[model samples]
Target: MRTIQLKKILNEHCIQFIEKKQMDLSLSIEDANSSLHSASNSTAGDKHDTSRAMMHLEIEKKSKQLNEVVQLKKLIPILIDNSQQKSFGVGTVVETNAGSFYMSFNAGKKEIEGQSFTFISLASPLAQAFKNNLNKKEFQFMQKTYTILKTF
Candidate 1:
């Protein structure tokens, strides 16, 4: 497949993942809210207090996670701009002797069109190593030398 097509596919996948995360987090938050409500109605004093506290904490944590997902959702569109892919940076697909990677965000490994591409974040150590070897087409990680096959 063409690099841009694959990139677009990966971008779509990222969006899907983000949407699923948002939905899941929202559901968890709702569940915690319901639990908090139930806990508030309980007659047991100390036990009710502890359950309410736990539910509040859970809601707070889920809200923070949802906010992070929102921020990540905002990043997806900006990061997927169809500019030239020339270097080891975001919005580029890099293939190395070790494996193929799509440098966007750490979406983990995905099998698309029967090929495995590890979606990685630019801030990742592997991406940093790739950037350091951009010109050389080779890098060393974990004591094993890997060569850059292509970038798109």
Candidate 2:
């Protein structure tokens, strides 16, 4: 596992968490505004209905964002230290003949240092493929092949 790749993975996770938080905040503000509008126009049933609809949409958006926040919280602990990661733990970078990749507890893909890398959560299919593989070994996915060259 390359240190640079691990750092990149952690940095990316941090950015994603920040973005999700921003989205959550924005949705909260929108929801509040919808409620206020609905209150102000209570005399008009149609306007109140429209505001209610908008509020529903905002609630859905906030719910999704909250779910994302929960996922991000699970990832935050792992991202805190890219270095000194436990063996076979999430956020531990793995070096392969194909390239350097980060093993995340959250599934995703990323590129680092001009190299394309796959980010797989601990429970992901690809992570399971490589898990418990102590020695250098070959891993095949969708006809593409990669070898676990080393572990840092």
State which candidate has the highest lDDT: 1
lDDT by residue for model 2 (1-152), tens: 45665566655765684666757667786767668676766776886777777777776777677676666666665565644665776666677877766666543556555666665566777677777564648867768787887655
Q: Summing lDDT over every window of 10 consecutive residues in candidate 1, give the lowest-scoring window.
A: 81-90
Pull out the clashing pairs in model 2: none
Q: How many backbone clashes does candidate 2 have?
A: 0
Candidate 1 lDDT for residue 42: 73
Cα lDDT of model 1 by residue, 2-111, tens digit: 76677888888888888999999999999889888877877978877888888898899999999999988887866677425565577877888887888777777889
TM-score, cand. 1 vs. native: 0.91
lDDT of each: 0.82, 0.66
